[model samples]
Every structure is written in structure tokens, then in C-alpha cells.
Target: MSEAKSPQSTVDVNTMTAIGAPRYGDGSVLRTEVVVRPNPRPDEILVRVRAASVCQGDAHLLTGMPYLLRLGFGLRRPKDPIIGHDLAGEVVAVGCEVTGFRPGDAVFGSVNSGAFAEYACVSAQRLAIAPTGLPLEEAAALPDSGMTALQGLRDVGQLTAGQSVLVNGASGGVGTAAIQLAKALGAEVTAVCSTRHIETMRSLGADHVIDYTTDDFTASDRRYDVLLDLIGNRSLRHCRRVLAPKGSFVSSAGAPGGDWAGPIVWMGKIVLANLFVGQQIGILLMRPRRTDLEFLAGLTAAGKLRPLIEKRYPLAQAGAAVQHVLDGHAQGKTLLVV
Candidate 1:
């Protein structure tokens, strides 16, 4: 982490550049715009964003898929025009109630919808000190995927040492993080990806790597204690078949479906099926917490968690960066260098 000069001495700036989604649409609808620089609230801090990573959620926000999300985000247009959430940067200014952070301290965390900007205001409760020696861009990748993986396996799945977990769609951002976090928790990890990502999963400390292109992992006789599904393309029957008698099924997303309902339709099936099965079935929508960010930082400092970054793009090309993730072409995390 680099402790450098602060961008603002006294919150004097009035405007900054940001990627704006004026209306809900695809990545093509995103454009660069000069927006007002946000001032920190009483419980927020202003970050001079050095780097931010593109996530699948950003794509959803762009297109407003799963029309259900619009109820909260917006009915017709996004409540916020700016895009992105995961960010890493230096603290230039703090709110009146903020503590433990000072100007020039390297920090990383998820913001609501303004991380793609040159500056963003983040709630103090959502920010954490960046791990020692980790690059801001790499640390930038940790907040969203890392927290989802940690909460899904440790909190939702109740994974423990000597147990086993099989991760489907094991080459994307969340999948890669789950593979390493599961190992750190002492659970055996079987990563399921296509032929190209088999080696990527193994390099992330997965105990077993299933090539989904050449074989059907669900057909195997072996069973696992937990099934972490990042891609919800497989039917529930196929998913439950690989779990142990008391195993748990957790999904963060599903295959692209109708634009109006999207993956939520699939997620709803998991909830409806949970009542009839002996195996626990649930969907994970991570609730980000400061404590979880601290835990992930500790793991990074101890070398137990290392975010795998596959590509870097300039802030000007954020649209393409987001499209890459939406298209499911990125093998790991995709970062935007501001």
C-alpha cells in the first residue's frame, strides 16, 4: 500500500469525472461525464479512488435486469447516475464522526454507486484499512467477492474443517475468492469450471478441479458438505444430487434469464425448494459489514487471501470493463485504473 499525498486539503473541489449511467441500459449506454464531487457525510469519508473493479452487479445496475431491483434502486431510472462499488484509494478527507483513518491512509471498501468516479464518498462503517503490501487495485477486488464468499461459506453454509465444498462457476470473481477462502477455513474445495480455467482453480488452492466442459460433476458418486453455486445454470435436482445428506446449497447468482426478472426467478426456486428437502437450500445476498472487511484484510496480510486480477482498464474505458464481466468473459477480477 502506498501512503501518498492527499488530493484535497479541505474539500475544496466542486466537481470530478465519473462514469455515469443516466438511465438503465446496457454497457453501451454508459458515458463519461463531469459530476459534482460528493462531500463526506457525518459518517462517511471521501476517497480519492485510485482503482475500482467491475462486478456483475454493476452490469445489472446498468441494464436494470430483474426489474425487481428497480423497486429499490429506481422504478424507471437508477436513483444514482454514477456506477461501480468496489474501490481502493487514499483518504483525503473524513467526516466529523470518522475515526482511525487520516489523510493519505490507504483504504479499500465498497461504496453504494460512485466508485467509478475519481472521488467517492463511503460510509465509515463500510471502509477498512488496506492490507500491508497489497496493491490498491488488487485490494480493490476484495470487498465485494471476498465478503460474499466469506459470508456464504462461513456464515450461511456453516462450513468447517474436515468438511468439503464444491464451487460451481469457479473461475469468476466470487468463485475464485470462495476457492481460496474455503481452503483457509480447512474445507476441501472442488472447483468446477470449463477446460480453460481448470488450472486457474488448482492454482487457487482448490483440492479438486472439475472440467465442466468434458464431464458432469453432478454425476460423480462423491458427495460434498456444501455446494457453492455462483452460476445458477444447473437445475436444483442436479445440484442436490452431489450434496451429502445434510449438505447446504448456496447461490449468489443465476444464469441470464428474462430482462424483467433475470436471475431472481431462479433464486426464487431455491427458496421454494428449501422447505421440502433434507439438505439446506438457500441463496446468498451478502450484507457487507466493516468487521467482514477487517477479517478479509487480515487474511490478505497473512497471505491466506489473495485476489486474482485478470485485466486492467483505464477509467475512460469503464464501459468495456463492465461489459467484459457482463459477458462472462473475464477469468477473474477486472480492474479499472483511475
Candidate 2:
């Protein structure tokens, strides 16, 4: 793993510029320049990033999917020029009044800006300690995907012991975490992934693995109390066919399109239909927070939860890593070594 560079004597941290639109896939998005933003604000902690993960979500952000987001981000550019979401690093500087951290403490968190650089600033509330035995690359994969998985299963889906939960994108980042967390929560888990990934999900404790290429899961005779569609492919009408009575649906698969509209537009139908139907269609944004992160970290430390990192790329090769995620065959979380 690469260590983060210290702030230079002159105050410039070598940073990459997110100035260009990705013409096509990840290959077109290049990090070839350095930008030095003024040091972080008072409420922020500047971190020397040790490692970070390349998520599919980051790919969508780069591609400017969800057309609505561009208006706020930039008509043709990203508002946060340098983009990345999950980060794990040592604190290099802390603002006044910041507690629970010091300059050298190893920490992991999510932030709103520029995670792809050598140094990133994060809010104190979004970060938590990296477990002593955990690798920086592993812990870096936790915040966004991990929090989404845990929050989706418990808070959003209301998953319970003996309850059956089906995760559609069961081999991706959030899907991998959700499978383990659902099993840890005592739910009967079913995973939907490619045929090549069936055994992988089984190793993670999925009770059943349905290969989408071979057969359709929603077309199956079985029913689930919670249908978690991380891929966001199903329309409300199609999804309703598979839900059990009073079941809920939560979608994490973001769309690639005009502005920044989410799959919730389709989910909105699930909501309206629910008023007259028996099922309780559900959807909400996943917030990355310390309380939920600590729980995930504890699970990782104790062996109940683990990241299924399909691959790792160095900082220079980070664009390739993003491309891999954009290609959409990566089995789980993809990480970027500093």
C-alpha cells in the first residue's frame, strides 16, 4: 500500500484535475494535472490518503449520468473537479475543535469532494477508525457501499431473522456487503449474480444463487419479503410480481442519463401502486455516517463482514480501475492502492 504524502512546505499537495468529460468509457477519463485547492476549512480534517476504492457509482458520476445532476455540478463539467468517494488514510491535519482524531491516526471515511488526490478533506462526523488488523485498501471500501448495504437491509428493508431477502446485484460492492450483513442479521439470503459468480456468492453465505443469464429471478416461483435491486433494472410492475405481501423494494442501481434523475422515478410508481396494493414499496437515499460505519468496521474486525475486492490498481493505474468498474463485470468492490 502507498503512504500519503505530507503537505509540502509551500502548502501545495500534488493533486489531479477532474477537468475533462469522459468521452466514452473509463479510459478517456485521465488524471494528468495537479491542482492545489486552498487548504481545507475549519470543520474539515485533511487526510493523507493511504488507499481508496473505485466504485461503479464513481463511474456514473464521471459519465454524468442522471442528467439532472449536471445542472448543479456543471452544465458540462463536474462541480468537484477531482472525484472519488471512499477513502482510508492517516489524518495529516485537523481543524480547531475537531475531537476524536489526531494528525497520525489511521481513519476511514466518505467525503463530498476530491477523494482521488494525494490529500482529501473530510468532515469529522463521516469518518471512523480503521480496525487495527484491517488493511487500508479493505477499510477504504467500507463507507459508501458498506453503509448502503447495512442501512438498506435494516433501516430501509426492515430485514429480520428468518426473513427472506433477495439481493439482485449480489456480486457487486453493495451486494457483497449486503449478503454478509443479511446473513449476520439471521436472514435467509438469496443472491442474484452471473453464472460465473454463483460460487462466490455461496461462499459469502447466500442460501441460493440465481444466475440472471441462465434464468430470470423475478420470474421464479419463490417470493421474498425484501427485494433489494442494486442493479435497478426492474420496473415497479415487474418487481411487484416477485414481492411477497407487504414486501418492500429498495433500489441502489443508479441510472446513466439526462441530468441526475435516480431510479426512484420508476420507484415512484412502486409507491403509487402501493397505495392501492398490499405490498409496501420502499426507497431512500443511503447516507454515509460514523454510527453505521463503526458497526460495519466492527463486523469486519470480528470476521462477520469482509469486502470482496475483485481487484486492486495503483494510483497511476487508477483510471484503469475506474474503467474496470464501468465495464461492469467486477465481482465486488474494486480498490485503488495509493
Candidate 3:
């Protein structure tokens, strides 16, 4: 791997735009001249993005889809100039207070912003060691998608053994991971996806599969103890119909703008709704934490959970990767092999 650009190739955020093409707006794609902050804050560490993966949220922000997320990411453009957050790489430098990681340690994690460049500054708290057994390209898949699954199902859904959980959009990014995680947590996982993807979802351990093309999952009399909705296609009423009286509904954001008025909007609505009933409905933010990554590493290291990567691209093709995620309909996560 190339050494982190010495303080030499490095320039202020205004001086550079790497080879990646940054999405400019509704009909624009720029040369991606990016701003690279020269130094880290007291709690930050600079990571060289060895590999990065695209998430649906990244694509939404890139394309200004759903329209409303513009409020949170940016009204007209993205807040982060470079749009890749699920990253894995070696740390080149650490801030004055960073202790968990040091120069040369291999790490993987997500950042609130910035991951597409050769180097990026991340809060020390957001990173965790990458899995020792996995290659950097593969480990890059964990922090964002894996942790989202772990948090959304285990933490947000409060998934437990014997509960029947339905994962909508089960063939997409977070959906793929949730199926594995729900099964690990002992839930009888039900994966809801288009007909083309039922076999794939079933291969991931979904106890039952619902093909959205042929039938409406909400119309079925079969109810669930937990509903993990990755796509917002189903209405609250639709979810409520199949929700057992004491069951809860956990929403994993997809598309954007409309499904969320920013993440806080959905979160607030769920919190408020939870007050009136035994069922729980709320948005989930799956942060990449050390413990969560480590737990997932244990699972990967053992072979219980597999990252079903759809395709891998070289770094120069990063835009195509983003576009692929935007187009949707992949069997699993799409990665950039940097």
C-alpha cells in the first residue's frame, strides 16, 4: 500500500480533487476537486481509504433523491464533498488524544462524513480494528452495513429468540445483513423482497420469504413479532396489520428525503408513537462502534455471517460503484477495491 501521502502531496481542502468524479447536482458530475483538511482535530485520526463500499444512503445523497434529505445532507449539494463512508484502511496519523489506534494499524469503520479520498480524518471513536481474517476489501464491508444490521435488528428491533421478524427489501444492502443478524439473534427471519431475490434471501437464512411482486406482505394474516422495514414502501397501517399486539416495528431507512425528514424526524415520530401502544415504531441509526465491529468480526471469523458482496470495483471506478448502488437491485453490498 502506498504510504499515506507525506505532508508533501497533502494540501489544504481547497487544493485537490482526486480522480473520483463527485456528483454535483440534479444533472451534474464534477471533476471532484475536493478540499483535504491538512490536519486532524484533537479527537480525529487520518485514514487512507484502502477500500470503500457504497451504501444506498450515499447514493441518495449523491443524487438528491427523495428530495427532503437535502435538508440534512445539504439543500442543493452534499455536505461531504466526497461520498464514501464505509471504509477500511491503515491509520497513518492520530490526533493528540487518540489512543485506541496508532499509525499503521489496520482499521475499518464509518464516518459521519468523508471517505472517498486517499486520506480522511475520522473521530477516533468511530473506528475499530478490521477483522484479522478478512482482506481489507472484504473487511471494508463491515463497519457500515454489518454494524447497521447489528444495531437495527439487535438494538433497534430488540430482536430475540422465538420472535418472527420480517426484513423488507431483504436483498439490498442492510437487508442482507439484517437477515443474517436476525437469525444469529435467534429470530425466525422472514425476508420480503422481489421475486427475483427470494432464493438469495432464503440462502441467507430467512425462515420464510415473501415475493413483493406476486403478493402484498401486509395483506397476509401471518403476523410478526418484529418488523424490520429496510424500504419505506409499506405504510404504518400496512405494518400494523401484521404486527402482533405486542410486537414492535423498526424502520431501516431507504431512498431518503420522504421516508425521513432527516433521521431525527422519523426518530421523533417513532418515539411518540411508542407511547400509545405495545408495538414500537422508530428509525434506527446504526453507528459503527468498536464493540459492534468486534462482535461482527467474531461472527465473520467463525463463519456464521457472510458479507454477500455483489461486485468489486477498482478505486478509479468509484463513480460507477456509486451509480450501481443508485440503480439498485444488487444481491448484496457493492465494494470498491482500492
Candidate 4:
């Protein structure tokens, strides 16, 4: 981690550049604008964001879809207009109540909002020290996707050593992280992805790789103890077909069904089906926490896990970066460098 830098002696603290959306819409709604720099609350810290990563959640929020989300996110407009989550940077100022961090400490964690900017105010509780020797961009990429993978495999799937696990959509940010994490947990990993990503999946420690273009993984006789579905394209019945009896099926992805409905209808269906089956069928809603961030940081520091960054965009091009993630072709993470 970097020592705290003295912003008072080195830089101006008035205004900063940030990406903000005036109203919920497509990526074009996002624009780079100058805004007043924020101050840390009594329990918060002011961070000069060096880097941040774009996630599917950010894309979903940009549209304010499912209308249900708007209940808490803002019915007419986002409650907080600035949107972003994963961030890695240096703390330039700490609130009086803050103790674990000081100015200049490099940290990585999720922000509730306002991360696509030169500076952001994050609660001390949401952050952890960045892994030693890890670049800010890579560290920034780890929090959201990495935590989702860890929680899904360990907490939801109950994956155990020597268990057979299959990761669907094995090329995206969460899928890549899941592959490595499942291996780290001693599970034999089978990754399902497109033809081009087979080698990439294998390189990430997958014991087997299936190209979805040439083969339907659900049609195979292979049975897995846990199926981590990052692509919700398949039906629940199809997914259950590949699961071993009494095994777990965790779904983390779904297609947008309706403006107000979103994936809730599908998730409800899974819940209903669970009543008749012996297998575990459910959806994963990833919650970000500081302890999980620290645990993942430890793994990264020990070289047990690493984030795969597919592209980097400067602050000025943040809109394009978000579009790339929305397009659903990025092999790993897309980062924004400040």
C-alpha cells in the first residue's frame, strides 16, 4: 500500500471531473462534467480515485430498469446521479472518526455511488487496504466481481474440496473470478464459454473447458456438484438436468424481461421450482462488504488470485467503457484510469 500523500501541500481541493447521468437512459446519457469535490463525512474518507472498474450492475443502474429498482434508486431519476461501484485509490483526507486509514493510504473497495470521478468520498467501513504490489487498476477490478465469485462459490454453493463445479459464462469478469476461486477452494472446475475463450479458461485453472458454440453443456451426461450460472440464457429445467442429485444450482444472470419485471419473474420461478426438486436452485444477489474485500486482497497479495483486465479507459472516455460492458463482449474487466 502507498503512504498517505499530503494533498494540502500538493494539490487544489475545490472541483473535480466526474461522469454523471442527468437521467436514466443508455450509455450516451453519461457525460464528463466538472463538479464540486466532496468532503468526507465524520465516518468517511476522501479518496482521490486513481482507477475504477465498470460492472454489469453499473450498466443496469444506468437504465434504471425493472422500475422496481427505482423504488430505492429514485423513481424519476437516480437518487444519486453519479454512478459507479468498484474503486481503488489513495486516501487524501480522513474524517475525525476514521482510524484504520489516513491520507495517502492506497485502498480498494466498493463505493455506494460516485466512483467515476477524480475524487470520491467513501465510508471507511466500505474500504480495505489495497493488496501490496497490486496495481490500482487490477485492484479496482477485484472488489465487485471477486466478491460475487467468492460468495457464490463458498457461501451459496457450499463448494467443497474435490467437489465438481461448472461455471457458465466463464469468460466475463465474474466468471473468470469464479473459475480461479473455485480452483482455490479445491473444487474441480469445468468452465463453459465460447470457442475463443476455452484456452483462456483452461489457463485460469479450469480442469475442463466446454465451448458452448459447439456443444450444449446441459446436454452432456457430466454431472456437477455445483453449477454457477453467470449466463441466465438457459431454462431452470435445462440447468437442473446437468446437476447431480442434491447438488446446488446458483444463478447470477438473467435477460431483461420487462421494464418493471426484469429478472424477478424468473427468480420467482426458480423459487417455485425448488419446492418440487431435491436439488438446490436459487439466485445470487451479491452484497459488498469490507471483510470480503480484505479476504480477496489477501488472496491477491499471496498470488492465489488475480484479476484479468480486458481494457482500460481514461476518465474522459468512461461512457465508452460502460458501453463496452453493456455490449457483453468484454472477456474480463473494463477499467477507468483517472
Number of clashing pairs per prediction, in order: 0, 10, 5, 3
- In the order shown, what is each candidate's alpha-carbon RMSD? 4.6, 4.1, 4.9, 4.9
Sliding window of 10 residues with minimal summed lDDT for model 3: 1-10
Residue pairs in candidate 4 whose N, alpha carbon or C atoms collide under 3 angstroms: 4-103, 4-104, 5-104
Q: For candidate 2, lDDT tens digit of each residue in 232-254?
A: 76666777788888887776663
TM-score versus the correct structure, for each prediction:
0.94, 0.90, 0.85, 0.94
Model 4 regions more than 4 Å off = 1-12
- Candidate 3, residue 327: Cα displacement in angstroms equals 1.6
Tens-digit lDDT string for candidate 3 (1-338)? 11122122445544433433244442135233445444678898888778888877667677665556666677656666666778889998899988878888998888776676667788887888877678877887777788888888788778788889988888987888889988888889889889888888888998899898998999999989889888777667778889998887887763333543544555566677778777777678766677887898788777778788989976556666777776668779988765
Cα distance off (Å), candidate 2, residue 259:
7.9
| Error of model 3, residue 160, in angstroms | 1.3
Worst 10 residues of 4 by lDDT: 1-10
lDDT of 1 at 281: 91
lDDT of each: 0.88, 0.78, 0.75, 0.89
What count of clashes does model 2 give? 10
Error of 4 at 158 (Å): 0.8
Task: Count backbone overlaps in model 3.
Answer: 5
Please say which candidate is ahead in TM-score: 2 or 4. Answer: 4
